[model samples]
Target: MTYTIRQAVAADLPLLADIERAAGALFADANIGEVDVDDVAELRLIESVARAGGVFVAVKDDAPVGFILAAPLDIHIHIYELSVHPAHGRQGLGRRLVDAVCDDASARGFKAVTLSTFRDVPWNAPFYASCGFRILDPAEWTPAFYLAHYHEADMGLPLERRCFMRKELK
Candidate 1:
């Protein structure tokens, strides 16, 4: 199916939260404890990120089916969240969203794109690795990376099972 990728507007913000919830549900079957109960990005946060030109939606039939939220952190753009409704999964929407952020960051002269994800989840760190991201060792953590990990830990995520990854943009 055809899909359009574009920066999100205010009207698209609420749908992004819904998409996040739906996409996150898949984790229920992954043997990861309670990930499905994790909170999604709130509309306010999504809106704030969008205002920064860091929210992008994948649209089909004029409605958002997936989205990626990002923000400037240090010299890189950090992907705060990425979600695609399961009905549209395994069709490259996630990669498209990642590419959208990477391309925009490249054009704007950002050095890289960064994110934190579950280290052992097949669709988490491994998928990002396939997208050219490398798992960043703690020694490589920037201030922004440290801050990201702090927030993730505060959210009750298992730090030992989590890792930060980065994809440098040319």
Candidate 2:
């Protein structure tokens, strides 16, 4: 099926929230218990998608199947979130969304893009590695990156073991 990727509008908030909830539940089921399904972060995500960022939704035959959210962070673009509906997994939609975000970062003159995901999850770290993101070594990581990881840790997330990945856009 052909999916069209387009910028998200305010009207897309409801569906986006639904997608986030479904994706979060899938993660929880995969043993990622650190995530709180009822957390307000999902609401904040919708707000982020509506401002200072770009959200690309993959719509197939008029139905939203997946979406990716990208926002500038210092000199790089951070892929805040990307999720494909559970039913749509392994269908290339995720990669397509990432590719679109990278293209946008390149066009905006960003030097790189960064994201973090569970290190041992098949649907996380390994998937990103295949897309050219290399796991950053803690010793070589920037102070900002370290702080970000620490913040995640404070949020009850197991970020100490999560892999921070970065891909140069240039």
The C-alpha TM-scores of every prediction are: 0.95, 0.88
Off by over 4 Å in 1: 36-38
Number of the top lDDT candidate = 1
For candidate 2, write residues 1-170 as lDDT tens digits.
67787777666656776676677777766675667655534656667755865788888776788888878765788887888887777789889899989998898888888987889888788999999899988886777777778888878777655878899886
RMSD per model, one decimal: 1.2, 1.9
Per-candidate Cα lDDT values, in order, are 0.88, 0.79
Clashes per model (N, Cα, C within 3 A) = 0, 0
After best superposition, candidate 2 residue 53: deviation in angstroms?
3.5
Best by TM-score: 1
